[model samples]
Target: MGRPVVHFEITGRDGQALRSFYTRLFDWQIDADNPMGYGMVAREGNTTEDGVGIGGGIAGMPEGEGGGYVTFYVSVPDVEATLTQVESLGGSRALGPEKISDDLVIGQFRDPEGNLIGVIQAMSQSA
Candidate 1:
């Protein structure tokens, strides 16, 4: 099967402000206890659902980074293998095969035209 765009992120200099704006604008549910300066956006009436309607986060930009950018993450079966494929296709690793949880690994890369893209590997239910 082909990879599917599974997630998205919006990074900015002010995470709280961004979170507030999005929450008000979309009526999303954003909690205040994001230790990483990241806010999870839960759509109304579907807060308990998993993988519904393009899940997203609002993140604070790292120090020295100029502005905000949006990134979309594609779901993959294997992050390391996808990184190799990205490199072979003239892309370059931009972030990591980093673990977000015991069941999720994520990575980012720059495409040939320098667009930042993300990939995620979600562990199987039987894993």
Candidate 2:
């Protein structure tokens, strides 16, 4: 199998407000923090009933302009191996193997087009 879009981040101007909107609108359970400006919410992309990846977005604030979302994540069976391939393929890594939950390891990277993407390996599959 090939590397798939596993995880993605939604960057916006008002992250907290967005989180609230999603939480109430989508019925998504959101765990939010003020200082961290991050939301732990279940995005439809990575999660399915059976088992899949998980991701959320960083809370953003309006910074002199309109708000928008940026950054996305990809799903990989193995983060280390995929990261190697990314480097070899001329992709740049922003962060990695950051443990988000018990079974989730996330790596942030940029593709050849300079588009940011995230790779997620759920613990259920990691084992």
Q: For residues 1-127, what per-residue lDDT tens digits would candidate 2 score against the true structure? A: 6656644566577777777787788667776754575776665544678777566665675577546656666667777777888899999877786887787888877889877677788777764
Mind giving the per-residue lDDT tens digits that candidate 1 earns over 48-104?
Answer: 457357677888888899698899999888888889999999999988899888999
Cα lDDT listed for each candidate: 0.83, 0.71
Off by over 4 Å in 2: 20-37, 40-58, 61-69
Residue 92 CA displacement from its true place in model 1, Å: 1.0
Off by over 4 Å in 1: 43-52, 125-127
Query: What overall lDDT, based on C-alpha atoms, would model 2 receive against the true structure?
Result: 0.71
**Alpha-carbon deviation at 2 in model 1, angstroms:** 1.7
Specify the highest-TM-score model's number: 1
TM-score, candidate number 1: 0.84
